[model samples]
Target: MLLVLSEQEKTSFTFLTSLPEQVYPDLVKTALSQLLSTKQITKVVNSAAAKLKVEVASLTNSSLYVLSQCLLNSAKRNLTPEDLTSSLKACGVEVTIVTPLVISYTENRDILIDIITRSTVQAPEYRSMEWRLECQVGSRSLHNTVIPNVLTKWKISDPRFNNLKTKETYLNCDVNTLQHITESLRAAQLELDTLHARKMCRNLARIG
Candidate 1:
């Protein structure tokens, strides 16, 4: 069945869906559960070598995955699923999700370690720092960061984030509530990015 959603809803859905279940299988379920503590989301814990490697580097490696929705809807870009997906891989971010999607995390001993061993980062800092998102979707280690400010801005809630609702409102977030927070974040961030881009354009125009 087709589901109707706000631009943000769709954006968050696509991003969370593409991520590895190991990190946030119960993303929807857990988002409902106090929005996944920011503390848990930011640091990797009790993970094997592979899971540890991937989650640590999610931001730089998977900008497209994280930004695909915003780029498509807010920036009015015509990025295809393949395009964004490929861009993510090319950037060295890992992505995986099993069928019959889970709302909570499960054991994933089978999660490939090939990506972790074979992946190459261009810089020392990128090599050491991790890239895990709250949801543990596609992740990567960046050789050189091109967008630090924008990257920080992209990360809204938590690494364990399948949803972005504040916790005071509910014990765990439901799909309905998840959708609400996603839209709110998207609207605010898209506008911020648009303005940031516009100012850069104006500055360039003046320089020329």
Candidate 2:
């Protein structure tokens, strides 16, 4: 799939294309390496400025940020090197400039994809639920009085943690409150099954 570039991204690509063709591999390598390690690209930018005898602001503003973003998005979407090259070319980048980027992508494809997959947020899932009915037959001041309540326990699991983390919650409510809670949950479930939600899921699937 072709990448759609914003106006600012177009400017970034233009800046990259204007640089000496020989610098392409090292520049793309620095960008991808720093990104893979979750480090800032400031050093690379500063070095590039010194080598090119240009202001750091020019490179920072027109290039590095967008370059990192492009690399991250490409990895996140698991784009093939050829697809990435085509997309960059479509953005007006020269074949020479695109070559290094594709090479970096090809070399680091597995690691990049693995990191992106691991970093994706997975929603907490229901594990178990227990509930009991409680009745209060009398109060200290009043005799012959009766009240009923529901006591509920819920457990949820979050997969993001190194260990499978679990959370527990306790709730006490009257019949009306319990009914309201049940109806609210049912409504939420219905919402998820709606056409709009299905469309959104499709869109997200395409993106990921």
Highest-scoring model, TM-score: 2
Candidate 2 yields a Cα-based lDDT of: 0.79
Number of clashing residue pairs, candidate 2: 0
lDDT of 2 by residue, 94-170 (tens): 78877777887788888887877788777778889999999999989979988889999989886666328998889
Q: After superposition, how far is residue 71 of candidate 2 from its true place, in Å?
A: 1.6
Which is the leading candidate under lDDT?
Answer: 2
lDDT score at residue 108, model 1, on the 0-100 scale: 16
Off by over 4 Å in 1: 1-21, 28-75, 97-199, 202-208
RMSD of each: 25.6, 5.1
Q: TM per model?
A: 0.20, 0.63
What is candidate 2's CA lDDT for residue 200? 96
- Cα displacement (Å) at residue 105, model 1: 20
Tens-place lDDT digits, model 1, residues 138-193: 33774443422111112233323323321221133444565687899999778767
